[model samples]
Target chain A: MAEPAYLVASDSETTGEEKSSSPFPDIAIGIDIGTSQCSVAVWSGSQVELVRNTRNQKLMRSYVTFKDEIPAGGVSNQLAHEYEMLSGAAIFNMKRLIGRVDTDPVVHASKSLPFLVQTLNIGVRPFIAALVKNMWRSTTPEEVLAIFLVELRAMAEVQLKRPVRNVVLTIPVSFSRFQITRIERACAMAGLQVLRLMPEPTAVALLYAQQQQQSVHENMGSGSEKIALIFNMGAGFCDVAVTATAGGVSQIKALAGTALGGEDILLNMMRHLLPDMDTHFSTRGIDEIRRMGLLRVATQDAIHKLSSQSSVQIDVDLGNGRKISKALGREEFEDVNWEIFEKCESLIKQCLHDAKVEVEDISDVILVGGCSNIPKLRNIITGVCKREIYNGINPLEAAVRGAALEGAVASGVNDPFGSLDLLTIQATPLSIGVRADGNSFVPIIHQNTTMPVRRDVIFTTVHDNQAEALIIVYEGDEKAMEKNHLLGYFKITGIPPALKGVPEINVCMDIDASNVLRVFAGVVMPGVQNPAGPVMEVRMPTVDDGHGWCAEALNRTYGSTLDLVTVQKKGAH
Target chain B: MYSNGVGHLPRSDPLRFSFLHSTRLENPPQFVSFRIRPGPAIRSSLNDTISERPAMSFYELLGIPETGSLVEIKQAYKQLARKYHPDVSPPGRAEEYTQAFIRVQEAYETLSDPRRRALYDRDMAKGVHLAFTARRRGIFDEQMEEKSEWKSRWQSQLSELKRKSMQKDSDDNMSWGARMRRERNQSS
Candidate 1:
């Protein structure tokens, strides 16, 4: 039989140049894979359109079930009810577990889920398994995610009637460069090429820009700039961004995010409703899994009800004569999740301070994501911005729609009505630096700096006749190097024999529009334009999985012998 | 990567996508003449222009008067940003547009903050640009003559140090240079 063009998975390494070089331009689709839900959208000629699955549902549950001979994902499978997903055979919430090691507190918190999550706490990947046929079948987060993505790709192909290869996926802003690589790896395994990975709020910002541009044309105005504060809280992450939009270009001024989200609220509520929930679910037997599922469904229902109502009553009976009943009031729920709400407020303030934007100057306040409808979250956002929420966008669909617009714009598509004339100038969400000056993070490119940027800093040897220096790159906002995410490390050698602090080491970091990071280093003596040796240019985030222990190993071996100190004062750029 | 001539620009295009290309000149003849002039003189002249130069004032880059209001500065920045951002620019000239876009952002970054802008203005009045205070670039720029001048200066300085050390050695036969060499050898 001849191979079906739509069914064959293409090579994963095809780049944008190659895609554009082809005769027929391939318009990449936009996908938002949320922690609890997933949606796909594409630019169909003049406007963005969301694609539906076989059941004609736009938003599908994000999970994969391994109950049968062949595993089935939520994309096409017909799930009877919510309880079915909470069963031990289904593995969900991969967004929280993906790219996180066992030592991460987030992974430790996930141990209470119905599925089996085992951690050794040795700075390695956590062990995740699904109960299949009375046996614990081991699997990885990447594998589960890829399986789900494949189903989505098949459904899109069937609907669009073309070979779907490229995609633009929206991710959480707090995800590290290492986490991004894992997402890319999963996409590759699913036989999909990632064109662009946009942070969720930036994607929403792009959509808002398009809307503002249209409004400006309708009014025939001068296209004055409009600043919008975007707060997105989903099941997995919370992100805040400040954007200034004018003439269809949304320039991100600042961004802040954290891993705290709605999932924490659910867990908190569960613990409150059942005080001994941990001890009860500690033993992962089939009966215990079923009982956990029952309580989880009840608590989730109560929380959803608390969004619209003032109070809710949760009543569930676990087998073995365990019965619990309680009333959860809105005020009580707020008290339970007060820490998460406080963090959200602080993130918004930090973003505003970094962007140099005042709350009164904010023209629009956009609330998006799954948890945006919660009354407490809504009040917190409005209180922080001191403005009513903008109702122009749908909270859940905004991210996917913006992603679709980016996909169309980046694919070199054109529209006669000028709707496709849009752009998003992104900023680095975290500071990128090198470990220097006694384990201090000397940032070369500070957070909130615009893209396609190049900044260099000069450093010198800390010891006399030090021939080599280690350039360990990290990405974070922390002052200490250990608190940041280690991207990569290399050594610069062949320095001329000189006194301490005499040999100049020039380290330059460049981030392109597509967000590719490159670090360049060379040794230059005084008054010499020619470096002592050839320059070394390496792409960043070179460390792979299990990199959590790499920094410790380096410290143990090198012992600060190959240290460097900053030669210039502040604001060297 | 440091070829330092026109020949390297096109060859380096694939590796450093936006770096050299954004700074690529439109007129070939003007670029050649610009490169032929002495480095320090041209650099000093460019620095005085307050635009596209290392010491260029933020006001000039945004095309606003030094006394321009914050609103006026923001308006100018937004206008230029629209004109030069790579995504909105014509596809063929995207690289060239990116360079202007970055300069606009840099100007805005400083001028958008009142405290930073005030300090920058003070420094501008003193004729001491912040760009000159730090040792940033290496030999990666495409200026051949500048590199050669730097090399000659370094060679002359090294020779002067050697000459002074030799003279001292001839006078005392136990110069500090000899002592330092002995210490270095022992340490090694």
Candidate 2:
């Protein structure tokens, strides 16, 4: 729906009156279901049209307040006053909480919020609830997200004046296949088909690719392709991607992301301003919730002002004779959130190194997302890139806009419009492998490998007369599977009785273009199609609930007697 | 060849000549020749300095200046590596590109590591053959006396590292339970 930018895109710009009829006559919408904010946009015949709610707010607060029998999402229903939002009924930040176990630090962090977040830390889902009329009403993170999506869909349908079903959602690069499944289920619950789930920074890269294609028309310049470093950090996650673009081909060289963002910084600053503040603002009755809301609002506004000015003052009274008055400086703000800034710098460095590019190789540094506007964050990025940033794209809407462009491209819209030819060759952001080498994590497909990729690693039995070998699959960069995210696991039985290091158990991981991961395992003799054992192929991330615990239990029950070591890394050294 | 002027050619480079016994050297000196000039009886890669030089530093392979920043190093490697990446290049030249790509990758691996890069830089800075020079200074020489002590310490560490690596390579095949049992027995 960004007319000015799309105007610079597509061949239709040149053939004006020829295709004025409408660029995208039919298309699915792109939605960025962010942790704190959400937005939806679509290719509207000629250009993208950002759908707005009845309140005319393009960016809807991602929250579902449970008050009446029927809950209300912020997108569908707006509360008249800020105080009403603090009624201890709204469940916000569901994106961070979804698909997480109680032991997760983020779940622990959520315990400080206004609503109830009770945890046993026993690998089960945390208990989340909202206080309504002095009674605690239980809810799951998935339920909260489904309600929000339903509201967002209704708004988009109303604006499009048609039944909106298909959508392309922008997700964090660090999101595991397990997390993707949760997002798909949420979409399914909302009565929508997921045409594609694009990583946030990859979506930005697509937009950059289109821009590069359009710019080719104006400048007969350099003629060389350009490499862009896209750093996107919203309220919930921070993601980085390096892409090479030429003639509409956006080949993603590297991608890196961390589950840390504005919310963590805001929480850090709040704790700094009010020491032992958790004791005062922890989940309680509706009155304490109101106090928590007031303080949060004050802290958020102060942080926003800090971005513009050097300092800001905060004076707010949480009822019950609690008064807080403080003057916060910008340096103090950065000092409080040093880890966030440090991570931002390291992520950029890691992405650059992974892409095998030096700062000089980067033709443009694109900073997007809500956090990109912060002065300190911007300076940190400049320090790493050793150059100024390209801020032509609006920070707030870039991810959604990129997603919208992807929707048009994915819809098979061939064009008199130049944008349709845009293609992005993505890469795996993390390694996918299994536990082998006496519990050492052996990766079959490493991070930064071009997709859709297929690679196999051979493993052998650790003990003599072994029959079955356990293939516990995981995805992450860690050297130990204990530290990585357990995707799924299976036991490959019927290995012909053999001495240690004799059986050839092959484990191959294939990641298709759609980012679907399938792991295949079989015991094979060299050059033989039919092996001594059955070949098992299974889709990953199906290992349900507390996989961290499951990995340990498997090892405890079944010793490493049948464990396998890598055959040999197959690339020429 | 070991250049007295600036950087030495990598010993592994096919273009460089290695140390040979003075008795075996038919020609005295040429564009490149062993300068350590060992007595007819002695033969050692360490005590004798090679006209062979050391392996190429990661920086030299990447074609970036030694003083180049980390970013510059990465950029140089990336651009060159991409030119040789098999996926993008024509398949008919796959063999040629594959070899070149490996070299580019090897260069990047060393240069990108701060610890490894610093180690290489230190070694590069010590371009002179102290061991060769000290040997000629004789046992009674003060400089030789001090160097011998330093040389012994380095030799011991080198042997220790060799032992550790040999153990590690074989340990890769050992199961976790077996390793624990072995450790327990060793402790007992």
Candidate 3:
């Protein structure tokens, strides 16, 4: 029940050391929940500890089962190899069912899973079952997630011998806003305070940078010279993120990813081989043959073996008193998984394009993922980009190590890796604009501009005898207000009624260090000597803060009953 | 429900689940009550009659406009309501304030809607009785008159007006104020 392995591994060492110095409350835990497996790691002081399941394995099957009774014999006996058969209740790959409705693409694709998927309508939303086969109870995705997180929280508490409160959960970048909300809600239900949500690829990159900094300190020229690209290809997905160090600051430049990776490649091989066998064998016979998890594992092993070997043979037990064996070569595996390779290639290309860097510009291509160990994948990457791929670190554990490093940085147990001082610039520029007569005014703040920039614009009142003005702010480069999302707006009330152009309102917008915009407005008087007064600072509401600026602006502008008027101002001699 | 656009039956629908009947409670007696209601002292007013009643200073009551700007209208409503809201105001004045606020809200809603505003204006011009029922019926009738030539003509005129304003905005690039500001800044 402790936080997952990948979450705390980087910061574990620091925490272990700190434990001896002072008694610090255990607040942070990390979790890595994968489709086939799940792992938890907890940080105590400077030491990082992992909780192993009964099998002495860090990864859980991601399966849950419900029945009238719990399975007897608290632990499974590996000697009998009867673990799968003696189950009173078992569920597998429940993570896949989390936050997914029946209509979700992933849910539909998962129908082929050997497990049963139950459907239930809860309130206004529908939830899908996560486990294969048994359905004793119906639960929402958030509830399933909460079950996992709660277990993790308990594990951490047991290790620390005290209560743990704060947690950081890693999510895929492709996860939508709705999915993130479900995850957050699950964390809340589990009684763990979610301090922050880190993207999986970002965590992996941080880990890699931290390790690279320690080993190749001399090779890294200066605080600003360290630059590397982290390529994480996991079972469910693959992501590529570019990070650079300049002035001791390390920041993510751009990230590109895809849902298809090593898992799909293995699954596709099964799909092809299984259907072909079905043509020759009975459908039920083939079903029995495919039920064995070992067959899938054998196929994956063969693929992994073929990555290094010129050829490999896979022995298959046909379930009955028959056995068949076939030899597969590297070329054969590549041909079978060409589509998946293409997807990885496209994602890498997108990452490069987003970062505005070419393959030649990349100093190092660090590969992290269990699949990256496949010889064929490494060869393909090397051949395509014509660069030697770095595999010095274990692909499977690299993300965990990196996550721990980030933990150390966040908890202030260790100084951020030397790459932290990178003068990295934004990959995409943010623009601020206003809507006028259905069109937008996009002025200054060009995309990719350095951070901490301020811009100002002046405008006259839209109508005559207008005492108050409403200014709507938006983020994005779209020319229409409808297209761009409105961040928020503020009202400048108590303006004296002047001819349409007589009064001037100066609106100044400043994007601070954290990339959040702050707006201020003031009324500028005409030629008369007037005492200077402080400008009214307006507080912008965040999307997560419950109040939306757009709704407020709509209520202020559209809710108003004033009519438009155009009046000429008296000329001054 | 589907025909009415609510779409599909609820999951708890009795017809969908046969087991629901077993869980249902046994028959219960139904209760009925009857009462006689008194008629109002005043008869229902006609839309034309209300429209014919001289246009009161509803905008002034709301502190907005017969021709107020959008900002002015919003500010006036907020200010007037804050002062006269039943919950916020004195109990003795609550009823009067509530009535005034309701009247202002009704007037604003009518004028804010172009179709309602037009019908009211037409009734006022014709000196016709403006009863709520008649106004509602007239609006519904107007909505149902598809492909009416008069509506199309008015739409075309509105579109032309929009196009002209957009063009004028583009043409007048350097306003006097902007030019003066530039000159003044340079001199300073």
Better of 1 and 3 by TM-score: 1
- Which is the better candidate, 2 or 3, if ranked by DockQ? 2
Docking quality level of the chain pair in candidate 3:
incorrect
**What digit string (tens of lDDT, one per residue) describes model 1 on residues A26-121?**
677899999999999999988999999999999999999999989999998998887788789999999999988888889998999889899997
- Tens digit of lDDT per residue, candidate 3, span A515-538? 334566666556533312445565
Report the TM-score measured on chain A for model 2. 0.93
Task: Report the first chain's TM-score for all candidates.
Answer: 0.94, 0.93, 0.64
Best by DockQ: 1
Give one digit per residue, the lDDT tens place, for model 2 in A400-516.
Answer: 988888777655444566665566667888888888765566667778876545555567887788888889888887533455788888898888776777778867666543456
lDDT of 1 at A41: 97
Residue ranges of candidate 3 with Cα displaced over 4 Å: A1-22, A42-56, A67-97, A118-127, A130-136, A215-224, A246-248, A276-298, A308-326, A414-573, B1-188
lDDT leader: 1
Q: How well is candidate 1 docked (DockQ)?
A: 0.06
What lDDT, from 0 to 1, does candidate 3 have? Answer: 0.49
Q: How displaced is residue A257 in candidate 1, in Å? A: 0.3
* Candidate 1 vs candidate 2, lDDT winner: 1
Order by lDDT, highest first: 1, 2, 3
